[model samples]
Target: MVKAKQINVNNLPISILDINEDDYFCLTHMTKNQQEGSKIIEKWLTNKNTIEFLGVWEQLNNPNFNSHEFGGIMSEAGTNRFYLSVKQWVERTKAMGITARTGKYGGTYAHKDIAFNFGLYISPLFNLLLIKEFQRLKEIENNQYGLEWNVKRILSKANYHIQTDAINNYIIPTLNYSQKKEWIYADEADLLNIVLFGCTAKQWRDANPERSLNGENIRDIASINELTILSNIESLNSTLIKNNVDKKNRFKILLETVQEQRRTLDNIDFIKSMK
Candidate 1:
């Protein structure tokens, strides 16, 4: 079953229509400014330019787009008594994505990619304004993300030396003396440190003794989201190390991993309640 979520964009609530784990789109109704909205949609429906624009978009993004059905809709787009609704477009043409519904919280919204096109149809000025606002929001979000990441990086670095010293003082002494057992045994905390910081405690201290060990000029603390990623990384790294994989290679592999696990990581929804 598809799960739907309501999200706020520029004070407007939009529904996130998820068809599956991967397939989804945003849906909202057209704006309430009736005269302006109708004029915009009417012009869009009748203009040859609008038809061509929709055609190109469907070709590129919609795998299940029904071109024959859409042709019928386009043919009847501009009659004196004719009417069109978002539901009609979806039902008739299997448009796959369109704005629908009614009431105070309703207005048209589209998938991020398609919304820009709709904005252009409304007015070039509207499109420009929307783009500007969205870009500004994105910049603010990116700056916050960068700050959080750097903070986590510093925390992990500082804890490295402490973890390494613990391992050397506590773990190493407990190991059996065997000819091939010259390696140091890592504790859970050390492993977690490795996952988050991409280095062992001893390694970090050796590389930056002044900061990791001495605690002077240490980096900022991590955000909750970063801590979660670090925790997962540590668990995975622990398993890899137990299997005797090379530490340097494991660090390189983890660095190459993408952060596309879910929207929970990229979006601010998780921490919104705290605010």
Candidate 2:
């Protein structure tokens, strides 16, 4: 029940119905002005070819897809006396995805992957037009997301330096431990920094070796994404240290968290580019 957004394509505002959190497809209806288009889609949806296409897509993408349910839908498709709406198909087949609802701006939509197949049913030219529009929309969305990401990266960098300085001044001096012990703790901090920034403190230092001895290195010059991840890692590590959690386990958790964030950002970027 995710609220869907509408996208304008060639002056026509098309609703993007969500197939999942990250994926969507288009829909239109069969009113007098659009009956031709609607009939084309209906013909496609109820056809044996369409049923096969849907079945194959479900099998490939849906782990919980009910084959028996889909079989029932397929069995009833394409009879003059048997009319099937999108809701019926979805409910009957227990489909993970479907286009539903109609009347007054309601039309047929399918998952983007499914829509592409429907496009072919309309006409090669229509399919090409839809693909081009979608690609353009994706590009716009990606650019926006990328810009947002860059901004986030910048903020993260600034915050990281602030946090690091606090650690250096307030936390580091409080330890009565020897230099070796201090260095060991510093090394642990550096490990988390490296995981986020792709460089150990020493490596960063060496890379910018020409800088003044007191100058900040690469870790201090992190992008917003790295800094954001680093901040979370720092907080989590602080708690883990307090809880006497093993460094190895903490590192694993940190890496996994970073990986998940990266994937989410990447998906957003991907979706935006498709715009």
Candidate 3:
């Protein structure tokens, strides 16, 4: 599954494609703010330095690369009459550094190194933003797979379902003992919401109308650390409910817990140390 991930640079959306476990960033997407996107790709492809770099990269990484054919291409490179497309370069050098595709994720895509070089050639400022955004995305990706990361995120979501089930069986029964007491359920849910998020879910939606309109609530964008704390509070809330801890007392304790966790997690110096 080769999905496209987008990052914005200079307000232009650049797409990165993953094909065969390697990243291929779209050169076409990178030049939406510039004139002659394809021509710019062609200019980069024909440069003597770019050609040599591509050849060297192929030599180091691509086992089946044809060096004799690459030598022929090098002799012709840098001449005004010389021309190369990604397909031609790949075909000539037996290179895997770039690809040319022609569908939704189409256009010239290059290896990360080549993409960075092309990004710099476009604009150094854009290149800086590109790297920053790319690294941010890569970090997000890592968060989904690592064991410690999975344990925390999964614990939060899993415990939430458990709490909801307990509420359905126990808490809702006292509210008229009704089968369809939906607001009763909502009210209890918001008890935890107010404790952790400092607002009811409705208040969060109202405050963030743009995010709400897009169907994303406060929980959807919580930090990993916040989610970990939320997971902790869920366990405590579950125990408190079973023991019949009054809502007023629960709120005070939970609010204190939220503040303590925030002080620890939100400190800039502490976050830098983790990195």
Candidate 4:
């Protein structure tokens, strides 16, 4: 799947496409503010060194690349009549390193390796700036992912301790059978699931066989907002459990809490950043 993202390079928003986990930078957007940006790309394409570099990249990365056509283009490169367009290069050599996209993100995009080479044609300073900005963008994304992972871990720990402490302290002692006592934790977890997700874990699994086959649970696919509401309610439910509230009354309070917190968090866009 191809995903489109953008980054600011030298104050210009350049389009980047994520194709099969590789980032392809938009060469057209790189020089969009310059005079005759198209001509600049054309000049870069006609360079013999650029041609050789692109050919070698295609040979290395593209299994179905048309080496015969690439050799012909390479021979004619840097000659007076030699000219190449992004479309021509892609079609002739079956190149996967560059692409001409259409629609909203339409542009001539190149793989990062080829993009850095093309960046030199823009300017040494501009190229350096582009590299720096790209690195910064990647760092931000990595940090965000790491933070979310940590939040999930902390939520899991909090939920486990709060709910099990309540169960072991209050509910477990009343059950006569050991098997019934063992089920207390799962039953308590399902209470939270029913409140936030409108279904029990078992019900969710039954409804989604493929996901169940892949070892995913309802909570595994939950949005950030849903998880936050779940965390809030688990703590609330723990308090209710400790206070000796009956199951029916505790369910009502937890449901209300879930609804109220969801309404509050949904309105705040930052808190609703879904995975």
What's the distance in Å from true for residue 151, model 1? 2.2
Q: Which ten residues in a row have the lowest lDDT in candidate 2?
A: 26-35
Point out the higher-scoring one by lDDT: 1 or 4: 4
In order of appearance, the predictions have TM-scores of: 0.56, 0.58, 0.54, 0.63
Pairs that collide, model 3: none
Q: What is the lDDT of residue 113 in candidate 2?
A: 83
As a TM-score, model 2 comes out at: 0.58
What's model 1's lDDT at 220? Answer: 34
RMSD of each: 9.8, 9.2, 16.0, 7.9
Model 3 lowest lDDT segment of ten: 266-275
Kindly indicate the candidate among 2 and 4 with the higher TM-score: 4
Model 3 residue 129 lDDT?
A: 88
Error of model 3, residue 62, in angstroms: 0.7
What ordering of candidates by lDDT runs from best to worst? 4, 3, 2, 1
lDDT of 3 by residue, 161-196 (tens): 777776776777776567666676677668778877
Model 4, global lDDT: 0.85
The residue-level lDDT of candidate 1 at 52 comes to 54
- Candidate achieving the largest lDDT: 4
Model 3 spans with C-alpha error above 4 angstroms: 147-149, 152-275
Clash pairs, model 1 backbone = 28-108, 29-107, 29-108, 30-107, 30-108, 160-201
Each prediction's Cα lDDT score? 0.54, 0.65, 0.80, 0.85
